[model samples]
Target: MTELGFTLKVFRQIGMMKPILPHKMLGAGLQLVKWGPGFPSGVNAAAKRFPRQLAIIDDAGELTWSEFAAQINQLTQALKDRGIEAGDSVALLCRNHRYMLIAMIAIMQAGGRVLLLNTMASRSQLGELAKRENASLVIVDQEFLEVAGDVDQDKVILAWADDDAPAGLPSVAAISADQPTKGHSKPARNGQVVIFTSGTTGLPKGARREEPADLKPLVSFFGAIPYRGNATIVLAAPLFHSWGLINFGFGLSLAPTYVLRRRFEPTRVIKDIEEQKADALVVVPLMMQRMVDADPEVIKKADVSSLKITASSGSALAGELANHYMDTFTDSVYNFYGATETGWVTIASPTDLREAPGTAGVPPFRTTVRILDAEGKEVPRGETGVIHVGNDMPFGGYTDGNTKAFSDGLMSTGDLGHFDENGRLFVSGRDDDMIISGGENVFPRELEDALIDHPDVADVVVTGIDDDKFGQVLAAYVVVKDGKSLTEDDIKTYAKEHVARFAVPGKTMFLDELPRNPTGKVMKRELPEFE
Candidate 1:
């Protein structure tokens, strides 16, 4: 039987068959009855239907669906034997690997919460997170074992490198051999996963699931996407981020083949795509830029025709870069717009990129978006204001009692944008970054985009500086192209020709590079102040 057919059969046996709902009911009316067989049913169906199909590929090895499911069962039994129970939080710290995927499934399947840890995070950060979440168990790869320093070794489960198990640790391979199938397959309560969000304040806030109902719409929406049977998906982003989790869940729900990379390496990424024949990749803006900037000979040598979809998120994709990607691949390059608190709000297709250039496209199936003024009233279509979203998306309020993020049932994204006449979203800049110069609002993104068009400028960040006459003055930090020399007058001249006089940056500072987060988002907070 086909994978879809097998899934439907299992759903029927588990009495999970239900009518699919339209995307319009996503926020207000969608509900998921406990009629379906749940997560295990979908996984088991994939195993039965495509037992030999490759499910996961990493540096260690590739695991077929059957092997993957069997490993999950074994891990679940092992954890259970170790005194773990349902609803316990399992803190996981590891790079992208086959073991991590199996452990995540095993934990959730056993009715435990999976608390993802950022691999790049400091030891203090991880320890604080573990303590804050009250994790019952911790798992770490040998590389990250140092981060767990003095954190109760007894509570940690380390994956053995060789066949020999570490002292007090169960043999992962041996456990799989003992019982290929051992745990009950039941879906946990909705909102079982607690993802922590970075707070504006010092402490990070943990966002828990609201209701099982919220997941139904997402699950259904994912099913409708063009995921092929047992297709390989390249996972390059950090698993701790929301986009990373979304990609992981997408693969899990569809039971697709996945290729895991420990951390993004430009050369390795090119090699893996060709070697694994990966069909899809989920990347951020910086990763894509690096790949594009890699050696042309290496890019030409790599076989990228097998790739069908390239999805980007976490930061904005410049229109020039987007156009170049489409021209190079001749395939769909999707730009997803949303936040950690909110799931996908809108998706910009390659077609949209070609037509509208910078638009974030229409809202996702059931999402409602409104551009609101400071008073929370809707603004005109062409007027820019704060962007508010209302949907079935689940968000845990801030840990520091900052409920002000949400206003009138809509989540405040802290972003400034406006909807075109056709309802396309144009995210101009962050509200905090808006420069109030001489009583006029100047969005840096407009000026930044104009500056980027200059031949000498490789990258540029525009910000507001204190001014005596004006409330705030505009400043530009620019990274010039290698082997190219540019002066402040040249930059100013170029900006004046390309952008409005008020929008032109008043002061320009040349910099070797700008600070960026792991996800490729510019760290505006880290920018140095200039006189």
Candidate 2:
């Protein structure tokens, strides 16, 4: 078939599949085309449609669509007052609240790049990141002022300060109070958003992305996850991460009511879902685990049936955990598998999880997932290989000039995974995290999964430790369930029953919890050095 013929056929299939799509999706595309692609353009369109409807609910309270748009404009004007210009980098170091949300949109509206900074980063890490990114302005939450010591004093703005200001630094509220309610002039080019990798193995790197012209990817994403336009959403994931930011972007265009909190406290989160009657909850796997482990009565009281979808990403979801969440929430969980570099590769829908338990669902429309061996040849089904992906979201490459290896125009996801006969993907582990012990390639994830299956185990992380006899040996850090006890031998026995003897952890250590980054990835570097 001709290329044009194939493209037409693809669109025909999409129209047939999603005949009743939300009208706002079409409006979103038109708005982008008319006003040029940027966060401000989407917000302006939403304001026009739902002027009086609630757009955001955070710790600072709620704002209607019109109010939300006005704040964004005021913030943009304030940024202009401070000499922020197009293409300039503005680093945002606030938590999940109105301040961060406003800054993200305002920076783009004021013709500046939005550089999202992790709230969990230490002083040194924040300093290094700011310097590396060449951030022209650093807007920080007041609580994190200590970490902003290295940032240029003249270029600092404080937000979300409950206490009296630290003398000269301007607060976000102060800046937006006196500025114009209308948005600033259109920028020469649309500003981009840059998010940092979780940095499990090393220092974090930035993944930059520009505003998307085509809304087809977003529309296709809704088909996979079933998030309706204008649906109420509770964002539990940190906005600095890709997963949360993606949801926020959808909320902007779809004009959803966002229930935001500064932190992911299990009880409060459940209450918010129940009180807000939120239709969707965005979270990482660890946050879900915490919710599932909360007090039983509290969980029962929470009317989470309001939630139609619980979108999870940022890390692999253990099959056991997925099953538990689905059983609790009546199969409302949707596990999304992807990375910062590659937008979204696949989404494990409720039906897919019910049928296959752990399988990451088939690739969404226009996404391509390939599992290839070291030779760059496709591996047979059910055999693990390096996972590569191609999609509509164009990767802006790393700011440091480092790039993921690519073959045939598909970028490497840096993960090892295999597809089942049904074409559902299962991630095995990171390609670099594979341990060559006694000449056998053993992935830590396999051992971790085995340990997690134990009835007494609540959480587990497996790492390869140095060994004189074997090139390296497996060390397991185990977190037992509450009011439960398990010995090192018991864990070893459980592992022996589940996996090969060599793959069993050679050393076991008990811990109350595993150290994890903000995105819930196990911080392997922070683990204790085994004796």
Candidate 3:
């Protein structure tokens, strides 16, 4: 569709959904448009419009939009007083909590670049990242104090702690205690948020993103899902991820009540959903898998009836897992497919899951998905090729001066996928992970899917290894289900029944557990080598 048509469609969707919204909320959205595109602007608008409404609920307790805004402004002023000027880097290394959100808003509002650090990163990695980004300050939780690495004593701030506040550093609570409630003066430039890739394939690269020029993506999201003003959400996904940040950004205009937990405990998550009566859930695929794999009785007893949307991303949602989630919870699952660099490319609605089991669904209103060959030519629908995506929000190249190869104005997503006859997209594997055996090309996802179906197999990953006969053959690393046993032959027989001959694993290694990153992505490079 043309830009004019896309805008029209968005306006129409908003018109139809307007009656259900709070009075004058459309005026607030228009304010967002006029204020250009900055997170602080959207948040301040929400605070002014709905001052008394609940904005955040975390281990630190609840805060209304008015209180939320005040805390953000307080920290923003504090950063300014400490000589942290606009465009300076303020690295945030805390877990999911109200203070983390406050720090992000404050940094952006004060015009400081916000660097979201993965909490699981080692001290070496953290130190390297801080130096690479030229961080002016590092804010961390008390738990990470020992691992904060070398930084000026005055540049570090403790943002969250459960017990008594630590000495020698100004805690977030202390800084905000006597600070002003009003927002600080706007910065010279709208500081951007820097997100690092998950590093599943290699070393993580930092991806910088400026605020989008248009609100179409955000509007289109509301049209696609059931989010609205005052809706309550349990954000179980880590804030460091793209999916979690997207939800948080949406809340600026929609003013949804966010329920967050620092650590992910499957049972506690379910209990929070039940007690909070949350309307939606924000999560990664692995979190949903854990929820589905919970005790059937516990799942059955949980009051998930209030949940209208279950948004998942960050990894592939297996077909079986999607079906199981939809079956357990009234068809409320929505699987989103995108990368850290490209933003959201596709979303699988509940209906899409029912029709096409493992599909990532079609492109959203303004986005485009193309499957192209090595020569940059669009391939036939069913033929697997590299996935290229065009969207309103594209990453501004890597901070290390690395550029991704692009074709016809669309950026490569580094994924291999294909579109079916119904126009639904299916991710096969990474572009570099395809295996060739006996002159037949194979994708590891197919073999991995087949292996995961066995009752004894808990998780699995298939890698291509060198072999004299086929040049490159498949190797399987299997993690058996707890208290369950299966022989290598049993898995081989199951593979023979389910997939092509060339796709079957030549050798299988049983592991007690698969090594995964914090994001639940299997680090194949860290896997044990074959004997």
RMSD of 2: 3.5
lDDT tens per residue, model 2, 269-367: 889888988888999999988888888999887778888889999988874788888777657889999888888988998888888876778898778
Candidate 3, 100-123: lDDT as tens digits: 999998998878889887776667
Whose lDDT is greatest here?
2
Candidates' RMSD to native:
6.3, 3.5, 2.5
The per-model lDDT (C-alpha) reads: 0.70, 0.82, 0.81
Number of clashes recorded per candidate: 2, 0, 0
Q: Per-residue alpha-carbon lDDT of model 1 for 221-266, expressed as tens digits? A: 3432344545678889766677876776645545577888777988
Q: What is the TM-score of each candidate against the true structure?
A: 0.84, 0.92, 0.94
Report clash pairs, candidate 3. none
Question: How well does model 3 score by local distance difference test?
Answer: 0.81
Candidate achieving higher TM-score, 2 or 3: 3
Cα lDDT for residue 417, model 1?
A: 93
Model 1 regions more than 4 Å off = 1-42, 159-180, 185-191, 198-201, 209-216, 219-225, 398-404
lDDT of 3 at 145: 80
